[model samples]
Target: MTDTLLNEICALETALQQSQVRNDRIRLDGLLHESFEEIGRSGRHYCKATVLQDLSHALKAWHSAASRRMRRESAAAHSPQD
Candidate 1:
């Protein structure tokens, strides 16, 4: 179960990265939802605290990336050089 959870986390990270590359908001949201669901299901038979912690960390990473992207776009829009 731990291995499964780890694999799921890795898959979610990959999907997130791919979505980021394509700027696919819908796909990214879906992937995030699926990741949460998987974490919840896996928590039933695994270390609940650890699984939740991992999920939280994943969410934070995603949010951080999103925030950075938004900041970059905003900066570009306001740049006088552009």
Candidate 2:
């Protein structure tokens, strides 16, 4: 493979990872082709749109849950009942 093609593949891989971390659906959509699809482990199929939709909700829920836990920990650390 040409170095240019290899570099682009690497860049796309990095972009995919970054998009997942940040839940940036726009970037993810751009990276994927129009006809990309995945057959999930449960025998279900997910298209780009479905993946983006699910991740949007999943990421928000994960952040909110993590934030709540952090707040609880902070409050506990500051509480007088040691």
Candidate 3:
């Protein structure tokens, strides 16, 4: 691909990542094509609609896990020596 096309693709990829991180569903809808499809590692298939629907649930679980991990680390950091 030419440099200009490559740059555009890179920028779109960056936007998609940012949207996923931020859970920006509207932006994701705009970025993703209606015909998008994915074959996940588990051999399950997902399409654009399913992915958008699942994103909220996935992000919530991720946030909750991260929060718990941080709390554990913080408690460890603040624990008194034996």
Candidate 4:
């Protein structure tokens, strides 16, 4: 691929990651084509709607977990050491 195409592909990848992290459904939809379909490890099939719905839940869970982790780290950082 040419440099321009390669750069575009890389940028798309970054956008996809950001969309997932931010749970931006609009951006995610724009990133994927209508023909997109995901195959699960158990042979289940997922369409765009299913994926987006699941992504929102997953993102929320991740944020909660990350917040907990940060709070724990903060506590440890301020704790006294022997």
Candidate 5:
């Protein structure tokens, strides 16, 4: 990956970590969506098949993580664990 793309991904990862630390689901979800879209746009701009594939994988990973987080929170809220 290019330095710029790596930096962008790092920044997004940092933001995601911070959001999780703050328990800000709304902001976290928003950032996840934004990052996914940004990666998609980047792939389109780069016009590299490998980059596009990587971006798709990253997007799917982020989406899965976000979904898992949401489910965990919901379960905790409804369970006696909270």
Candidate 6:
């Protein structure tokens, strides 16, 4: 690919990664094609819908875990020292 095309592709990839990390569903929806499909390394098939669903679930789990950690730390910080 030409340098300009290569740069554009790289930029799109970086944008995709950032969107996923930030859980920006709107951005993802815009970036991914409706018929997008991926065959994972394990040979599992995933479509656009499946990928988005997985990301949503993962984001929920991550937030839950982070909240729990924050609560534990807060409790420990407030508790009297031994």
* TM-scores for all predictions: 0.42, 0.68, 0.58, 0.57, 0.41, 0.77
Alpha-carbon shift of residue 70 in model 3 (angstroms): 17
Error of 1 at 26 (Å): 22
lDDT tens per residue, model 1, 22-70: 3554454454443344334445542434444655677789899999999
Candidate 5 off by > 4 Å = 1-47
Report lDDT (CA) for all predictions.
0.62, 0.83, 0.85, 0.83, 0.62, 0.85
TM-score attained by model 2: 0.68
Candidate 5 structure quality by residue, lDDT tens digits, 1-82:
9999999989878876562532544454455543344345445542234434555676688889999999999988899752
Clashes of each: 0, 0, 0, 0, 0, 0
- Candidate 2: Cα lDDT at 43: 98
lDDT of 6 by residue, 1-43 (tens): 8999999989887887784543876678777889988899999
Candidate 4 C-alpha lDDT tens digits along 1-82: 8999999999887876674533877778777778879798999998888877887898789899999999999999999998
- Candidate 6 whole-model C-alpha lDDT, 0 to 1: 0.85
Model 4, position 8, has a per-residue lDDT of 99
After TM-score superposition, what is the CA distance of residue 3 in candidate 4 from its true location, in Å? 17
Candidate 2's C-alpha lDDT?
Answer: 0.83
- What are the clashing pairs of model 1? none
CA RMSD, predictions in order? 10.5, 3.0, 4.4, 5.2, 11.6, 2.7
By descending TM-score, how would the candidates be arranged?
A: 6, 2, 3, 4, 1, 5
Off by over 4 Å in 2: 1-22
Query: Which residue segments of model 6 deviate by more than 4 Å?
Result: 1-10, 17-22
